[model samples]
Target chain A: MTVLAVAEHRRGDLRPVSYEVVTAGREAADATGGDLHLAVIGGDVESFAEDLNREGVDAIHTVAVGEEFDHGVYAQALTQLWADVEPSLLLAPNTVNGLDYAPAVAERLDIPLVTDAVGVDAGEELVVTRELYGSKVETTLAVDADRAAVTVRPSEWAAAEGHGDATIEPFDADIDESALGARVTGFQEVGGGDVDIGEADVLVSVGRGIEEEDNLDIIQALADALDATVSASRPIVDNGWLPKDRQVGQSGKVVTPDVYIAIGISGAVQHVAGMKGADTIVAINNDPNAPIFDIADYGIVDDLFDVVPALTAEFQ
Target chain B: MKVLVTVKEVAAVDDEFEIDGLAIDDRYLSYDLNEWDEYAIEAAVQISEAREDVEVVTVTVGGPDTEETIRQALAKGADRAVRVWDDAIASAGLLDPATKATVLSAVVEEEDPDLILTGVQAADDGFGATGVTLASAIGWEWAAVVNSLDLDTEAGVASVHRELEGGVEETTEVDLPAVLTIQTGINDPRYASLRGIRQAQSKELAVQSLSDLGLDAGALDSPMEQTSLYEPETEGEATVYEGSAEETAGELAALLREKGVGEA
Candidate 1:
């Protein structure tokens, strides 16, 4: 069985999640004793091929569509490439571009697709583990198809690493211009001036338990004292206490910081999905039964008003 | 303009689930419309209210218990609802995503909707594949995680902005008769009013089974079977910090220093 991993890129640059896709593909390949092939589909992705030379990759196929992340072009290209390679398993990042084209590719290829894969194993039978109910429960599935297409969730698998001597091959796929009807016109940043919590090394994330808009000053002060960035759950943003950019959850930006101080956050499944990847999590909530404590590295059951000022002074 | 909005009912996030024989224990679990689909319903209603000659319809695959959920959408302003269920499918076992998409696409073919809307993913399954796959099965242009949408009925085109990771929103123009999976925070889903609830009792809710749609029971046979369902393992149990607010704060700061957070 040949396993193909699709590399995710933005414009000409490759995204970090591409390596995770490779890791997922490598795992499937190792389990099935199959060869692993990685593909990068974008204009000027040759350099990306060199960057993607991970140790377990058997070969790297670079398809130069000579365009930005065009959905139609990607679907057509993958379909053509799948026909050429006949891969038993196809893996792609469960991202904006990947989800856009993966379904169409699966349809065009007539392959069963299992998406948002958190855990997958190719044993006697193919099985995958996925989260449901906002990450509250896990469901395991056994795919009956011999050949399957899957989208691996971001931050679930560790990014692929180490160097390899895999040969880079340029793949030419037949492009159908008429099918490329939808066009990506532009990209805009929501709440442009807000801090990007995704890039923060340490985050002080507030939640609904923070009470009201005026209390945000205390959280901001704590962030300043710790020299960390400020983010929040959906309620904070929905309440207009913080900009949407500062929100972290399933609907918001996913962040993987070194230290995540979840102050007054109740740790809802959607909120936890975004920050669960943090190296160290410290949740401070008055509610001892808060689900955030399930995954928090450290827990503090206390009122934010009393804790925030004390923590701010201590950090200072 | 005819619109088809898809909705799903899922266990609440805080609900603890346990295996009751073959299925999860539902006695203590409360169900509501999936969070993302609420936004889809709201988007459908807003769009319908904005344009003249627009009607919003909803569809879901569920047993008889799903009628109340369907009625919730009707109260929220959907013109009609279709419940896709058949005794043959229920007896055959759980339906995989491909089968669900096939069933939904059959409904789409019957409705021939100018627009199809579904949540980015159901909170229950979290596969997030049905909308895109349904679009593929029916041969329609589609976009996922759409936060902003504008439909130009006259030109048969829809302009949408998709929310991507890292705070980026991509604007794209898709032709009408397309599918859009709405993201959360697109709009606030309204609570059903007393009048709307009373009026929903008389609204058109057409329940169609697999055979009714000319789809065979074999089509609903799921290739994927659930081997297990359980609470996911946690990496490590949380270590609680004890003291007064100030003392605990001091301890936390010292721990952060030891961990080398913030260049300590």
Candidate 2:
């Protein structure tokens, strides 16, 4: 009876989403009265186990094949591993790759699966909380199972700090040549110039409020003056004005920046899905009724074009 | 070259959308062609459009109600559409993604398409499994989140543009008859033209049953049950900006700096 938290990574670096899963897994294991086990499935990702171990987990399971990024390879390997571990609660970060494999694992095992769970509680039945209606609702779910699985939403739980001896155990599986399904051949990271939303301490995010697509220079200038990273609501990403990587929302990345300055954003639920975790949220929008105001720790109900230049000069 | 594009229909995203227990209000939920599936349709449409020899066929498992989605795919330029009719599919014990992949792989075997396309994830379920699962069952090559694609029909090669973190685009060329799940930013979906819509009305969309694909209706046991559904909770307050750009910038910089945002 173990709780498995699958660690997500890129290259060799552990993604912040994985930490979120750790928090969620810790919660699940506590509820289920099971040991929490961290699982890493990337090539040369052994080092990540040590870092994940620092979060005070019991053990780190490594399937450190170079083919970690391959979806089918991952799904089949995890399925075989689950057979060996038989975790009472299986956890993964609700990410693109995680989504790809978790359901397949559920189907292969014929187990109950809950995805994108924002909260978890144990009892006679394992209760999970999920955000519905694009973060407008939090739905409580009670699963009928002794063993269940889920993908944890990012930023829902705090990543535990401090260290424990997270022992690493290597799991070997029969990964046939055909099982890989797709070879990455190679990979290219998007927007090499900007810091990721998950890593940024401070963020000056733009929404539709910046007006014209060309008007983004002001937000860019603000990011520069602040030495802050730039993130955006979904529209900016969908419109191609900003890279998809820059967009923050349910579909995009969820970030927990130190201070989030939302420029001209109306704070739609989809938009807030990305920035809700910021420590201090400052919203600058013309419309007072905009939902962005609902979450702002401090707000300025003024036209953005008027406000941006003053701030740029002030920061300068 | 035959290419299969799998798409689905789901509840529209709304700030007001909440699951009232087991039921959802489809009225307030505006349905469009599924957003992630749009990428799949675009991939197929582009392949067939650029390469004269490539044939794109779209598939989905739904009832008479989902015909609208299949027609929209035709407007986007898929040559034909297949609809597998099964209300049981929703509750039939088979995982929605795996079952769909099983059915899809079976269909593809008959059509023998070189390429298969599906959205990276379904907007409604967000399960994101059909493409890879189908590829695995069929034992074919696959790529995911491919933002750009250029097809070489003659050489049976596909050059794909992949999006990565940090704003980098990776382009790779692979042999034909592979599967690719499209990233959201691949290309803007083409609106169904009146002509295309009219043509779609007459196009042949073969509807099959779960058994037709050799899948038992009750192959899966749902491990989770929907105990309750409710609206998601909104956190915090909205901030409205006022005043001139200069004045606001001044106030904004002060606020930002206080938050450790501004360097100067």
The regions of model 1 sitting more than 4 angstroms off are A194-203, A208-230, A238-241, A249-259, A264-280, A285-291, A301-316, B13-17, B242-264
True contacts kept of 2: 0.52
Provide backbone clash counts, one per model: 0, 54
DockQ scores of all models, one per candidate: 0.56, 0.38
Against the reference, the lDDT scores of all candidates come to 0.84, 0.72
True contacts kept of each: 0.76, 0.52
A114-151 per-residue lDDT for model 1 (tens digits):
88888989777789888765565678888888888989
For residue B107, give model 2's deviation from the true position in Å.
4.1
* Best-matching candidate per TM-score: 1
Which segments of model 2 are wrong by more than 4 Å? A103-112, A140-148, A191-231, A242-280, A284-294, A298-316, B13-19, B87-96, B102-111, B150-177, B211-216, B219-221, B237-264
DockQ of 2: 0.38
Q: What tens digits encode model 1's per-residue C-alpha lDDT throughout B1-264? A: 889999887766443446665466767577877878888999999998988888899998887887898889999899889888878866876566677888998898899889999998876677777888888888888998898999887887889999887667889999878999998777878999998898899998888988899988788766678878777675549988898998888888888888776564
Error of 2 at A190 (Å): 2.8
Docking class of 1: medium
